[model samples]
Target: MSSLRSSELDGDSDDSQLAAKFWEVKLPDVVPLDDLKAIEKTQAAEVIQRAWFSHMDKIIFQLLKHTICAAENCVTHEILKKVCPSEAALVKDPSVQCKVRFRFGGKNFPPFIVFKIFLHTGGHGNKYFSGKNTLRPSSEAVVDACKLMGNRKYYDQIIQDQLQFQKYKVADEVDVVTMKDYMHFTSFLDETPAYLGGKSNCWRRLSLENFPKTMIMYDIMDYATSGTLSDRLQKELKYLLQKPKSKEMHHDQLRIVSQVRHWG
Candidate 1:
């Protein structure tokens, strides 16, 4: 019995349970709203635009596709490094910009994470370059990339226009927006009636005299980004755990299965 117990612990330690709990506590670290405007201010427009260009599609696809690939590069890479270091290392290289290849509909999407044209070589001949994760491009690089990419570019135009009306939107849409309503609209992926005009108590006008629009979007994006990742990882890990562990149902299997059959 002692030898058997030891063998069981060695075979299936169930590391994922700890991982799931770890995820709950780990998500909020990256959602610093106060820092977003600072990020925008410090980052160049071009680099931001390029980061969006390279990684936005992947982000959207992952969200809409699996709905759980929510971890931003910084978080995802760290977690992945713990779970699968070899895979994480591929994209962590400063020189190697990473793009998530989506294999769906019998098609393939290649890696696209690149923001600048230049590359850096580390001391040990490792190629170190910035913009490996374009979505989170360094602020200065964003500005530089945007200038190089051009002013009338679609992304720049859209962001510029959006920032102009941010003050109005915050006053009319965000600041007064209640927590419940915000959760409903965002968590449900509400898009039909439109959040601002939607017919729900969750949508109400609150005084934004003290609210800053820049601060609001910054906070909103951080939540959206990190929450998405936490939700995704949990869902996938749960699905994996519930899968049957064996093909046969022997007498011993039945006894083992019945002993602690709470999981799946």
Candidate 2:
């Protein structure tokens, strides 16, 4: 039996050696450093180009939003004619002054035209209107104007873009609300007295003038009673109470607890 066990151990060792050799032969080929770097560079360039295109799209939308009359008669026909002659010719009615809606992007624009217009028309720094050059049209704006005049179907596209812009604006407002505004709302909810056993009208009656004092008092009470406070609230309280040098510093170090004593 011992001889059989020794033979089994030798067979196990041989199997392990074969497995190691198999892995050594089947290893994946290593990519060259130069090729890897080239791939990374191509990917980074694509990302940069996409970001640039998105930014330019936003700028074009803003320009169109401001310039377009949104009425039936093409009021800005003269400006459109100068910016995009080909597109201006396609306007529904050139005789009457009314609104013109423009579409932008894809094969409609000439190479480097957007950049040229952006530079000359002061589309940089988000200041489309600088000094006396307020109404100057950029190449992108021209291309967009052309698209609008050439295709009557693009009104829906422009409306969608406006909605997208408004969506982003609302998202930004929500982000702002989550910060200081949210804190104020929470404090108001906590302190305001209930009317008819409902807290709905508390917000309407909240006094902005007394907000600071109320917050300070609540912070002191919370700390003294060992009540849990969120990190943001604690930080705000610390600021309101002043630093370690202030006379209110001792309030943070004190805690009160109730205990019952029984007499036999």
lDDT of 2 by residue, 1-264 (tens): 999999999999999999988888666789999999999999999999999977655533332322221211223234344455664565534453323433222354211111011112233332222211221346566466557666554455346435533654321123345566555543433332332111222212111121122222222323323444535445444333333464344333221001111212
Superposed Cα deviation of residue 67, candidate 2 (Å) = 4.4
What is the per-residue lDDT of model 1 for residues 140-237, given as tens digits with 9 covering 90 to 100? 76688678868777365446436534643432223336776545534222221332222221211212121122222112233333433333334443
What does candidate 1 score on TM? 0.16
Taking every candidate in turn, the Cα RMSD to the unseen true structure, in Å, is 33.2, 29.1
TM-score of each: 0.16, 0.24
How large an RMSD does model 2 have? 29.1
Candidate 1 lDDT at 116 equals 11
Which parts of model 2 have CA positions greater than 4 angstroms off?
A: 1-3, 14-27, 67-264
Pick out the ten consecutive residues of candidate 2 with the lowest summed lDDT.
110-119
